[model samples]
Structures are given as C-alpha cells and as structure tokens.
Target: MASSTIIVMGVSGSGKTTVAEGLARRLDVPLAEADDFHPPANVAKMSAGTPLTDEDRAPWLDALGAWLAERDLAGGGGVMTCSALKRRYRDRLRAASPDVFFVHLTGDFDLIERRMRERKGHFMKAGLLRSQFADLEPLQPDEHGVAIDIGPAPDELVERAAEAVQRA
Candidate 1:
C-alpha cells in the first residue's frame, strides 16, 4: 500500500486534534496540528475573536502545503489537523500532496458551541464558530475522504476514522 497523508479537518471544537492524535497513534505516524503553523498575527486575530480572511490564511496554507510536500517527497504518511473550512483550502493541500485524504469531523452547532465554550486556553473563541460554519464547505463527492459525526467518543471516532482510511 502507498503511504497516505490524512488531514483531520473541521471547525473549532469539532474534535480535529483529538481525532488526529488518535489516528496518528493508530497509523503510527507523526501528528501535526495546524494551529501550530499559524503566524502570530493570525493567532492574535483569532484570539481577539476575529475570523481570518483568505489573505490572512495564504501564508499559513503555504506552510502546511510545504509540510505535506515534505512528507510526500519522503514517501512517508502522517496525520494533521486543519480547519480546512473551504474547498479551496483543501484543494491547496491536495495540490501539494496528491495522495492527501481528509477526515471531516462534524457535529451540531449547539454541541460544538458548548465544547468551544468549555475549552480553556484555546485562541479560538465560541464567538468565532459562526464565521467558521459560514466559511465551511462539506467535502464534495470527488474528494477522497470520510465524514464522521462528532457524537462518538474519541476512541470510537478514531476506530471509525481508521477503518475509513483503510477503505479509502
């Protein structure tokens, strides 16, 4: 089997990190958190409860693309977390690494909002959730990915994601 890059994506509070960490462990690959790739300005803006514009995201996406490219060139697989709220963003990633696959974690607004509100020390505020949802585009039919509901526990969700990745 070819090495595969798995991008665990979703809006804030949708369990991207948790799922990605689990998948990384299950797949025995390194885990990259997209938040760490953000520029300080982006982090400050998000911390101030401002949603990032495309302009603000360009360099960040490029950095992530570079990471994917590095993995691809090395012929290794890994998992990463990203908001990837728009098709264009995912497209950028796919352009960098053709074999990239996505695991989109989704849940109801109320559930996500509660989670965000309870999360501490995270730069993303609950107020920004609406903007995230507004910008989100679900994975299209042509996309190589899986959409898993966020209702399950972390372990179960990882199991499902692992199974899905195998199938893909």
Candidate 2:
C-alpha cells in the first residue's frame, strides 16, 4: 500500500489545517499549508472577500503538486492542507502523484460559519464562507480520498484519519 503524501481537503472552516498537522505529526512526515502556495493575487482577492475562479487557483494547485512530487521523490511524504473545493482541483493533485490521497473533513455549514466568525489571524475570512461552500464538490466515489466528520474531538478525528490512511 502507498504510505506517502496526503491532502487534507475541505472548505474554509473545516479544520483542514488542524487535521493535516495532526496527521503529519502522527505519521512523522512534513506538513504543508496549501494556503502558502497561493499567489499574492489570490490572497489579495480573498482578503477583499472575493471568491477565486478556477484560473486563479491553477497556479497555486500546480505549486502544491510540485511540492508533493518533490516530497514523494525524496522517499518521504507530507500532509498538505488545501481547500480543494472542486473536483478539477483534486484531479490536478492526483495527476501530480497517482498515489496521493485526500482526507476530506466534513462538517455542518452552520457550525463551520460560526467557527470561521470566531477565528482570527486566518487569511480566509468568515465573509467568504458561502462562496467556499458553493464552490465545493464533495469527493467522488472514484477519487482516492476518505471523508471524516469533524463532529468528533480533534484527537478522535486524527485517529480516524490515521486509520483511514493506514488502510488506504
């Protein structure tokens, strides 16, 4: 079974980063925040409460792909936190590394919005929650991914994700 490279995907407030970091730590792999791969233009647009088009996301996704490829070639892996809101976005990631897997954090919109509103020091503001949900396409059955509800405790979520990865 493939033992390397996982993408943690969800909308703005679904704990993608937290789960990714936790998984990376548990797996003893590096972790990457896909937000860091975003270009300045995308960040500026989001900061202005604007939703990014597919064009705006292509380069950022490509960068993520490159990072994954690099890590895989090094015979190690990393957990990357990416919104991966669309099917095409996930496809791009899979294309870069066929073995790449995704952990999809799922949660209720109300809960997510509430969390987003209370969160601070995050580039994605609460104002963009609706747009993010609108753009998100749940992982398809054929996709190399697993979905976990965030209704559980952080430790439970991480444990479930780790188990899923082990089985994947």
Candidate 3:
C-alpha cells in the first residue's frame, strides 16, 4: 500500500496520544503530538477552561500539516495527533498530503469525560469537553479513513486502528 500520513484525531480525552503512540510503533514510523504544535496562548486559553476559537487553531493546524508534509516527502509517513474536529481542518491536512489518513476515535460522552477527569498534569480541563463535542465532525463516507470506537481496551483499540490504517 502507498504510504500516507496517519492522523489520530478526536476530542480531548479520547486516547489520541495513546493510540497514536501505539500505532506509530506498530507502523515503525515517527510520531508527532498535535498539542506540541499549539502556541502558548492557545494552551493558556484551554487551561483556563475556555474553548479555543478557530483563529487559535489555525497556526496549530498549519504546523501539523507541515510535519505531515515533511514525513510524506521523506517517503516514510508517520503518525500524529490532532483534535481535527471539523472537516475543514482535516481538509487543510489533506492539502499538505493528498493521501492523509485519519483514525477517528469515538466513544460515549460520559466515558470520555471520565477519562479527562482522571487525567492529571494536563492543561485541558474536563469542563471544555462540551465545546469539543459541539465542534466534532466525524469522518464522512468520502473521507480516506476509518472511525474506531474507543470503548475497548487501549491496546485493543490501537491494534484495531492500526489494522484499518494499514489496510487503507
């Protein structure tokens, strides 16, 4: 199969980092975290429990796209995390790498909120989950990716996503 940048996307607390890490290892490719691409100002807003405006995310998305472009050009597509909750955001990544693939993690709101509350040392607060869900646009039929539910164990979910991503 042709290589394509894999974007592990979902709302915060949806195990994006976990799945991305495992998938990167399984695929033997480098990994990048979308959170690391965010500017300090954006992190501060989310830390304060305020939802980020589209303006706050533009630079972050561009940075991720650049990362994808770099890896795609290198002929070794890698994995990355992003709360690509909108179709337009995903489109921006696709513009950078036409074959970009998304592994969208989905789960019940209550379950995801519990994971967020249980997480520590993270800038994002559980309170902002509502805003994230409000902005989420799941993978469309025409999109080049798969949607995997987050209900299973972390390893199982990663295995399932890795298989789908590899097949695609």
Candidate 4:
C-alpha cells in the first residue's frame, strides 16, 4: 500500500490525540502531536485561555506541513493530531503533502467541554473550546477525509477511522 499521511483533526477536547495514537499504533507508523509543534508563545497563549489567531498558527502549520512532507518523501505512513479548524489550514497541509488524509473527530459541545475539563496537564484550557468550535469549518464535500462522531470508545473510534482510511 502507498504511504499516506493521516491527520486526526478536531477541537482540543474532541479526542484527536487518543484516536491518532491508536491509529498510529495500529498502522505501525510514527505519531506526531500538533501541540508539540507549537512554539512557546502559542502554548503560553493557549495556556492562558487565549485563542490563537491565524497569524499565530502560521508557523505551527508550516512545521506540521514539513513533517508530513518528510513522511511522504520517505514513503512512510504516519498519523498526527491537529485542530485544523479552517479550510485554509487543511489546504496548507494538502499543499505540503498532496496525498494527506484527514479523519475529523466531532462531538457535542457539552461532551467536548466536559472532556476538556477532565483532561490534565494539557496546555489548552477548557475556556478555549468555544473559540475552537467557533473557528472550526467541517470537512467539505470536496475534501478527502472522513468525519467520525466521537461518541464511541477509543478503540472503536480507531477501528472506524482505520476502516475509513482504508476505503479512502
């Protein structure tokens, strides 16, 4: 099978990391957390309950793009997590790795908020959930991806996502 870079995307509390990790493990590929690619300033801002503007995300997106590009060039599959809240951001990722696929995790606001509150040691505060949802633009008809409801167990979600990617 041809190697494809898979981006597990959603708002902070939507279980992107957990799902991505499972997918990566199942696929036997490297996993990259988009949060780790953020610069200190961006992390600090998010930690302080501030939403990141497009400008603030530019460099971070570029870093993620580079990571995907590298994986593509090496003919290695991988999974990564990102908010990817806008069409433009996803476009940038596609530009970097044309074969990149997205698995969009989504859930109700209340459920997401509760998950965010329960998470510990994360830089993103629960207060930023509103901003994330406000900025999110769901995958469009033309996008190459799947949108999976984040209501199932993590293992089940990974299975669903893996099946979707296989179909893609």
lDDT for each residue of candidate 1 in 59-126, tens digit (9 for 90 to 100): 99999999988888887788989999999999999999888999999999999999999989999999
TM-score of each: 0.98, 0.97, 0.97, 0.98
Clashing pairs in 3: none
lDDT values for all models: 0.93, 0.90, 0.92, 0.93
Backbone-clash count (model 2): 0
Worst 10 residues of 4 by lDDT: 1-10
| Candidate 1, position 95, lDDT | 93
Sort by lDDT, best first: what order?
4, 1, 3, 2
* TM-score of structure candidate 1: 0.98
Q: What C-alpha lDDT does candidate 4 achieve relative to the native structure?
A: 0.93
Q: How accurate is candidate 3 locally (lDDT)?
A: 0.92
- State the lDDT of candidate 2 residue by residue for 68-113, as single tens digits: 9998898788889999889988889888987898899999999999
Task: Please list the residue runs of candidate 3 whose C-alpha ends up more than 4 Å from where it truly belongs after superposition.
Answer: none
- RMSD in angstroms, all models? 0.9, 1.1, 1.0, 0.8
Ten-residue stretch with the least lDDT total in model 3:
1-10
Q: Which has the better lDDT: candidate 1, or candidate 3?
A: 1
